[model samples]
Target: MTGIKSIILAGGSGTRLWPLSREMYPKQFLKFGNTSLFQETVLRCLEVSDISEIFVVTNEVQKFFVIGQIKEMGHSIPPENVLIEPEGKNTLPAIFFGMTEIEKKFGNSVVGIFSSDHVLDLTAMETISAAESLASDFLVTFGIVPVFPHTGYGYIKTSEACGPGYRVSEFREKPDFETAEKYIKEGCLWNSGMFLFETGLFFEEVQKYAPSIFTSFENGGDINEIYANVEKVSIDYGIMEKSDRVAVVILEQKWSDLGNFAAIYDEFEKDSVGNVVYECDPLLLNSDGNLVYSKCGKIVSLIDVKDMVIVDTSDALLICPKSSSQKVKEIVTELKDRGDERAYMGQTVYRPWGSYTLLEVSPEHKIKNITVLPDHKLSLQLHYHRSEHWVIVKGMACVEVNGQQFFLRPGESTFIRAGERHRLSNPGKVPLEIIEVQLGELVDEADIVRFDDVYGRN
Candidate 1:
């Protein structure tokens, strides 16, 4: 058997799952349990493959989220293997980059490309092994048996069963409920986005069918050049739908691409009224089949509201019917049009070293409750337009302002003038909590000039 390499694609803005899953930090990083979807996805391959064989491809902004998640799980891959794309350009280019990298490092191995945001059954090792063994010239993807007539997922029609898979006859787009029921009756499977293929064979298909893809990548330049020019097409559109030698492995197991909150509600254990509520201290009267998540810790009781979604974060609230989940993207679109920051950034913002939850913000100033991880440090940088005041509220801090280095304890503070180099870090056993107040000409996030960074920002 060829040594397996897993390419985990952890890119994409899950705007459909807004209020919780923002543009900067999407659904992949959202936690269902102790582990995130991405972390669970990373750990999924380790059952049949080695830890060193796993390779994650994420953007520069969310790469640290990946690292932090893995660290929390205590299952670490080499940092070199965690390839960061300069920007996201859909799945094909990301997979191609990982395929090329796997070939360079491990030599034409079978690479399993899995999306980070999905939840799949892990007990089907036999099906996966069979697909891996049979992946000679075809890209083998797991097609799930449809439980309900869902229009969100694509369909795959197959011919005779071969080993654990069937030769794919055709790929169909998402259909209406009637068509979907017809598909289930016609022995069609839900196109589960998981794919297994040989790296060399995949490259051959790409070179043959997607020559423009190869040309856009230009014989694999740097990651920036690749992401900058690669056509924004998914694996289904770019390769799987167009490929002649695609195979579909029938996975008779529960699978979910939790693309939005509706799918999330389906996976959850519902209450007596068939409601899936998280974070909202619920006292329900007549709410049934609804998914409501609240970050504000308020009582959410309603009357006669059935099959709806109510997501209330600290800064925003989204309420829509279950049928209108697909239209949530339009809300995000309008927010962007109106320069609404809530669409992209949530109340909480992520950094390479740590994360800051926005308590408040205004024109001349912004207030944040910052949490820095132990042994983690932010970029040694200075703001061009803003100066910052840091007050240590919880743990000890290692502060550097201008040319001075000092230690700040609880209730102690420090300030950095505009254009003066400064860095805040936690060099303690506990998490450092600081109340940061930024006063500036303009407190925009883009006013930073990094001199040194621990997470390869240079």
Candidate 2:
């Protein structure tokens, strides 16, 4: 474990768990109790590697979530350790980027590749550490011992024993229910998407098997250019399935990818009627085997529902049979096809400074309840088409209109006309809350033009 480093892949959109998870706020950042899945992954990785040796690969949009979550955990990773991909090209490129960075910094070390959205028990770290011994000769992948016939996970077939693990005979895609049962009978392991790789051997395999991906990064001019030219492929397709040196280490740990609502149902505690409820109290008359998640804190009554998934948010609600929960991605696709804003954007949007909740919106005006974190400030910008009226609701606000700066306490108000450069800052220890009303013909986010930004927005 001393020579090992970790790279967390956290760029997934998580459309499978929509209505609760969105493009702007993915499942990795969603909290169940206190810690998020991303935070849980970070904590798991810390068991095997130092904080400095752990690297995270995320896209631009979710980078701040990675940083803010780590900061909240009372630890700080080096700024350079947080690698931002210009765009997502799937797991192969993201892992390659992390491996490339580790090679530059540490040089041919053993690196553990992990998914940011997985739920794994800490006991699995021992198996992962044991795989390090086999990393020099084989591309060691951790495969979970199958507990049931699960159609949601891919399968890895094992050949013979090799150095605390087995040689991977073949990799199989997610199959039908019958095929899944057959796979379990054949003693297949669920592909866990976790790996321990020796950088030298990893590079060699990449160069030999995925030459195009190899050459694109090797001849890199710019990060954006490299990403643009790289193929969008998963590591399993691009490297693992084709590599003969692949080894499988059996991980007998409590694990779940939580890919869909049904998977989420498996993670939580169930009631007397076999129902799982989160964040809301639901009246169940004859409901059984149902998952009801409501963020709006509304009273939901189920009379005779059974094996159903009911997820309610501020802007959208999803009601589906538990057996068809895997088809949630199709709903997201249809919403995108219909050009619905709820497909990507949630009611509450998080930013580096803080977050804003859309309270009301019409054709003529938009209302938002904004909260600025302590010592954080918004960008100095102006909206060409919208005029904003801000009323301080909590804490203290330092408002800047044009070049003039003034302080406003709770219940104080200010107005910024269209095309006026303004900024809002929280100068107090507590969070600054305000009611912002925007009036204009077009009051969308794209109307903003920033003159200055601390978080590097253009």
Candidate 3:
């Protein structure tokens, strides 16, 4: 049996699902239910391959999230197998990076490539296995049979049947509503952005169509430099469209890219009035179709509103018509152009040790609720422009400041002056929670100077 491995491409910033999905934390890491979409992808891949055989490709910023999520699942990827890209070139480069590593480890094996942010039905594993088995000479891609004429997705025109799959006649770009309906009438499939192929054959096709990309990897140069220099193009554009040996297996399972609030509404459970609410109790009177997501647990009351998307975070609130939800990216673009911190600053930021939630921020002071996992410690670090006061809220915290070590229980407090080296560790069996208050002239992540870090964040 040829060894099969799954390469999960999880580096996308997913700007389309903004506010909820920030640049630092993307949509794949967002929790729709108890688990995130990335965790679901991990579970899906495990059905087809072992944890050791699974390789994940992510950017440097997202590397810790990937590690934390995998650890939460009680599985581990070999540190070397978690290929980190210095920069996200696009899917082709990211997939190529993971595929190259898999080839080196298990030559010419069957590889299943999956996007980390898609919501898939139960038959995903079976469909992927079918695609992999049929990918001897052809690059196999999974195509979803469109339930409706969706103009948001690219369409795949299926030609003559080739074994269990169909030859991809042409790849159509995102069309207008009229063209989308026409494609649906003519039996087109939505490109699922999933692929299965043999290592050697896939590279051969890549060499033929995308010669520069193949040569960059073939020459054995610095991987990051190669990615930096290569054209930032998707795999569908770079190779799948041009390659003669391309096939798409029709997937008979529910699937959604969840590109917008409207799409997200479809995956969630709805009330009698067709309103979907998340994390908050929402009362809808005369409201027909509304999607509400509030992380702050504020009671949302809607009146006489239909087809609306209401997302309320701690720092931001978005209310827009569901029809124009796709234009939310424009807001993200505007925020980035204006250099607004809300565009990229997530309410809860995850670190290697655990995570922290931003409680408040003002001119002279900042507050955070920090949670450190059991047996984990932050870096031995100091700030140049700020001093920190830590109040233990839960569990036991082993604090170190200027070579002095002491344990602080709940309701206990400690202060570290500016330029003083300190470390906070959770010595207890449970999670350590602390309220951190910073008082200073300037306070931000850039002020930190780490002398020693267990996770190597210097």
Candidate 4:
């Protein structure tokens, strides 16, 4: 795998798994057993290639998350290898950006593109390797054999059998139930969106067909300007469907996109009564065919409930039947229209140093429980319309207010008035916990004016 590099696309909002997955923290970061879906993709890629040869393409906001999760998995990736797109221009531009980087380093080599949130069998690496071998002539894509009629996925119809793969006859969009069943009957496979491409050849096709995208990256202009000028489209519509040398390799194992709750329920472990329960225990009298998750540690008791998906977070709860789980994104759309904070953030917010949870919030006052990792510190900043009082509840904290430094222990406290520069530092071996009470007219994150920050935020 010397000339091969793995490109993981991880810039999806994943609104279908709402309440647990928000715009900032999506489903890829949510834990299942002991590992998350994104972490699982990294581990799987490491099995086939070296860590130094792997690349991740995410947005500006998700760059910190990618770094934190990779470090938490005990792997260190080069900062240059973690490419951050200015804004998401869909898969075509994202893949084009990553492919351009790979071309600079490895020349005309093989690259495997994968989605970070998909579930794949551990044995699928052999199929991936087989696809990589065919990358020199054809743009290779993996197709999963359909066990049933799945209308959520697009179909890849095979025209003729090639060596270890098949020549793609057509790329079909998501079909209705009748059309999906017809595709299944005709031996079509679900398009996995995973690809193996020879870097130079792929770019050559892009230049031939989608010349604007190719020229934008090739001209060495500003990325943000290039993205704004490029078209918002998927690779399937822009390249794969139009290319003559497209190939498909069949994956003979279990796989799922996990796009909605019904797909999750199908892949998740169920009880004898066909129920998927997570975290909190559920007492059910006659519940069957239900997927229940309670993240707040609250016991959920149900009587005679069946075929329902119940998800309870700190701020929101969703209950819908399994058949209607695909419509969950509509709820997210409604939230965005209504200007709800739950549309973008969860109860606990993560940062590069540590995390903070909203304890209470009101128009005039807001309270938060902040945790700082060992040897971590906050930015040197000041607020425009808010003052903050910090009470150290655990560990030691080094405080700096208006350029004056002082140390505080457990049960100690400090205050900084509005327009005064302040910073918080954890100087102890253990994690530092503080209770922060903010007061003023505007008490929000947008009020901060950062002078210096280690995490490089503006």
Candidate 5:
């Protein structure tokens, strides 16, 4: 446990738990009880061993969410350890990047790769430690004891037990209902897709099993180049399913991948009427087995719907049946095809400094409520197409315009002219809230000309 390093793969964008989890912010950054799934995974990694190091791999859009949650979790991991992937090449590349860094810093330590969106029973994970410790010459993979015939997950067949772990006999792809039911009866384990490995062994297997990925690393794991050549293959296809040196550790743990509406509906507490309501004021007249979430703390009423999801956010409202929840991604794809921001972002867009919620937007103007954390500063930027007027309403805000700096108190207002290099900073300890109004002939967010950004935006 002393030399164990953890790599939490936090780069999932297709997770369809929308309204709460979108393409920009997936389930990894979502708060379950108080802590997010990613934060809980990091904490669990700590408990598994005295984690020597931790690395999180995610894209730029998700970077702000990851950074904010990690900061809020109050871990000892340094800022430099958060690896930002310029572009995503699926799980294999992300895990390989972390493995590459671990090999650089601490050589040949046992590394555990955990998916940030899983709910695992910690007690069984303790058994995983023992299994990994005793595993010989194999990539140790944790397989959940299948409680039901799930066709969504792959299955692992093990022939013989080899000490604490079993040698993986074969890997089965997602099967039909009958095939899934037969696999469960034939003692096949649900491929948990979680793996633990000795760093050296894992890399050796990667070289032998996935030469494409290994060769991609030859160019210093340049993510853009990796994405250019690499096929859209998951780690299962890239390594585990093909690698001969693979072993399975059976985990009799309560685990679930909250990936879809059905899985989410199964996890919540339901009432006598069979409805899972997250909102306090949700009036469910006859809704049975429905999952409703109100992101803006507004009351929602489900009159006569059955087996549906009613998720109301400040910017979007999704009302669909459980059977149609999977089609929500199609809607997202259509939105992206139409170049709509609704596909990737919410009204409250997160930034490195803080967040800005779009209160209104029009052809010639837009209004936003910007919140800046203490000591946080916006970019030294200028809008070529619009002038912005800022009014502070919460805390003291320090503003800069045309080389002139001034402190603004609550109830005070200032205007930044177009093409003027200006910046905003929160000087107070509390959050600085400002009402920002933009005006121009053709105001557009794309006209921003940032001279400098601390968060490394171009």
Candidate 6:
């Protein structure tokens, strides 16, 4: 594992788990307990690689989540290792970007590409480490031994035995129930979407199979320009399915992608009545085989409900049968077609500085409970159409209005007229809390005009 590095893909919108997962805040950032799926993936990567050796590929919106969550774990990755894509061009480009970056600094090493949102037992890392020897010549993928006929995942058919794995004979798409059963009977393994690639061999395959994508990255232009030109394709479609040097390492450890609510229900611990309850204690009279998740911590009661998926967030509630959970992405599409912001964001949005919770909103006025982390500051910005009044509820605040700086204690207040540049900072050791009320004809996030930002926003 000396020359090995890890690449974590963290840019998926995760629409299937929506109402809990949003475009800006996806399932990888959601906490299952104290740790999120993204953090769990990072910890798993740490078993074989050091923090500095782990590279995370994410987009602009999720860059902070990647940095913030790593900080929460009492560790930090190299700032450059957190590669931010100008725009997502799917897994092929993302993985290529990570491989290119690793080659630049560390030079043609063995890289493990992993998904940010997956559940896996730690024993899987040992198998991953053992696959490095085969990775030198083959594009190695971990194939989970199918426990049942799972139609949700693609199947990998192995032809013959190779070094610590088998030669990949065929890659099957996600099949129908009957086809999935047939494949399982024929000893096909689930395609795990995780790969161990030697940089030299991976680049060679990419150059041969996906020459357009290879040329775009090989030209060495700006990342934004490169992403703009490259086609949107997955690694499976671009390279793995076309390459002849593919190998499948059978992973015997427990694994789940948790692609939908049904998959989540399968992973969670169920009650005696086969009900999975999260975040709140629920009263159920005759609820069997139901997954109830309430982030609002409200009392939920279900009577005679069976095999239902109930997700209650601060902004939306989703109720669908467990069998129909795969259709949740259709609901997200409808919301997007209707131009609903709820499809992209939740009531509570995370920022680089901290987080803000939307308390109330209307045509003329909007209110938010804003929390700034200790020693953090908001950008020096102004609103052309909105006037804001901020009242500090906790900690110390350093307020700057049009370059005149002043300090405000708890219970103190300040006002900024429309078009006046202002900024807020938390100078105390504790988090600064404030209630911000905006008055304007246009009360939206698009109204802000940032003059200077430390986090590099335009």
lDDT for position 216 in model 6: 94
In candidate 3, what residue range of length 10 has the lowest lDDT sum?
122-131
lDDT of 5 at 359: 93
lDDT per model, in order?
A: 0.85, 0.94, 0.89, 0.90, 0.81, 0.94
Per-residue lDDT of 240 in model 4: 95
* lDDT digits (tens) for residues 107-196 of candidate 1: 979988888998887776457766887688688898999998999989999997776678898999999999999999998999988889
- lDDT digits (tens) for residues 21-75 of candidate 2: 9999999999998999999999989989999999999988898999999999999
lDDT of 6: 0.94
Candidate 2 matches the true fold with a TM-score of: 0.99
Task: Kindly list the per-residue Cα lDDT of model 6 for residues 1-458, writing each as its tens digit.
Answer: 45579999999999999989999999999998899999999999999999999999999999999999999899988999999999888999999999999999898799999999999998899989999999988999999999888888999999999989999999999999999999999999999999999999999999999999999988878999898898889999999999999999999989999999999999999989899999987999978999999979799999999999999988899999999999999999999999999999999999999999999999999999999999999999999999999999999999999999999988999999999999999988999999999999999999999999999989
Residue-level lDDT of model 5, residues 1-458, one tens digit each, is 44567888888865377666777777787775788788878777876655348777777778777777777777556665678877777888788888888888877777788898888766765776776664438888888888888877899999888878789889999998899999999999999878888878877878887888888786654557666776555788888888887888888878887767777788888999888888558877867888888868677777778998888888788888887676777777777899987777788777889889999999999999999999899999998789999999999999999899999999999999888999999988999999999999867768888899998899
Which runs of model 5 end up more than 4 angstroms from their true locations?
A: 49-52, 134-136, 219-227
Model 3 off-target regions past 4 Å? none
Model 4 error, position 293 (Å): 0.7
lDDT of 4 by residue, 58-101 (tens): 98878888988998899998888898888888999999988888
Clashes of 4: 0
Per-residue lDDT of 31 in model 3: 88
Give every collision pair in model 3: none
> Whose TM-score is greatest here?
2
RMSD of each: 1.8, 0.9, 1.2, 1.3, 2.0, 1.1
How close is every model to the real structure, measured as TM-score? 0.95, 0.99, 0.98, 0.97, 0.94, 0.98
Better of 2 and 4 by lDDT: 2
lDDT of 3 by residue, 1-458 (tens): 22569999998877878889998889999888789999999998988899989999998888899998998899988998889888878888888888899989988889999999999975668767866667788999989999988989999999999877899999999999999999999999999999998989999998898988888788777887787677677899999999989998988889998898889998899998788988998888899888999978778998899999999988888999998999999999999999997788687888889999999998888999999999999999999999999999999999999999999999999999999999999988999999999999988888999999999787
